[model samples]
Target: ELERMNQEINRIGVNINQITHNNNSALYSREDKHRLYVFLKQIKTLVSQVQERL
Candidate 1:
């Protein structure tokens, strides 16, 4: 389960990185910004859970 979570975190991070890189060239639409916000929240929640377990 921990391994799976780790993989998920990595995947999310990669997606966020790509989105940010894309945004560097163009302005983010409202939907794009919302998606990024959601992604950040998910990462925060996952990290918090991981820390608790550790």
Candidate 2:
């Protein structure tokens, strides 16, 4: 489970980097921004859970 979570966190980090790259090329639409926000929230929650487990 910990490994899975770590992988997920890494994946999410990559996704965020992609989003930032896209934004630099051209600003993201409201929907895209919202999606990014959701992803960030999920990452935060996952990290909190992992911390609690530790």
Candidate 3:
């Protein structure tokens, strides 16, 4: 169970990283800038979830 949790944490971390990377891209205010904000928020949420679960 611990190992499974570890793997899940790692996977969520990777996903959060990817979202951060995408969110870190150059600005685009004219387009869907909200997407970046949403992604970053999701990253924060996921990180919190991982921390709580761990």
Deviating ranges (above 4 Å) for candidate 1: none
Separate clash counts for every candidate: 0, 0, 0
Candidate 3 lDDT for residue 43: 67
lDDT of each: 0.83, 0.83, 0.69
Candidate 1 global lDDT: 0.83
TM-score of each: 0.67, 0.66, 0.49
Question: How do the candidates rank by lDDT, highest first?
Answer: 1, 2, 3
lDDT of 3 by residue, 1-54 (tens): 778867876887787677556657753463556776676688678768867876
Could you tell me which residue pairs clash in candidate 1? none
- State, as a TM-score between 0 and 1, how close model 3 is to the true structure: 0.49
Which of the predicted structures, 2 or 3, would earn the higher lDDT when compared with the native?
Answer: 2
lDDT of 2 at 41: 87
Which residue pairs collide, candidate 2? none
The segments of candidate 3 whose C-alpha lies over 4 angstroms from its true place after superposition are: 26-54
Candidate 2 structure lDDT: 0.83
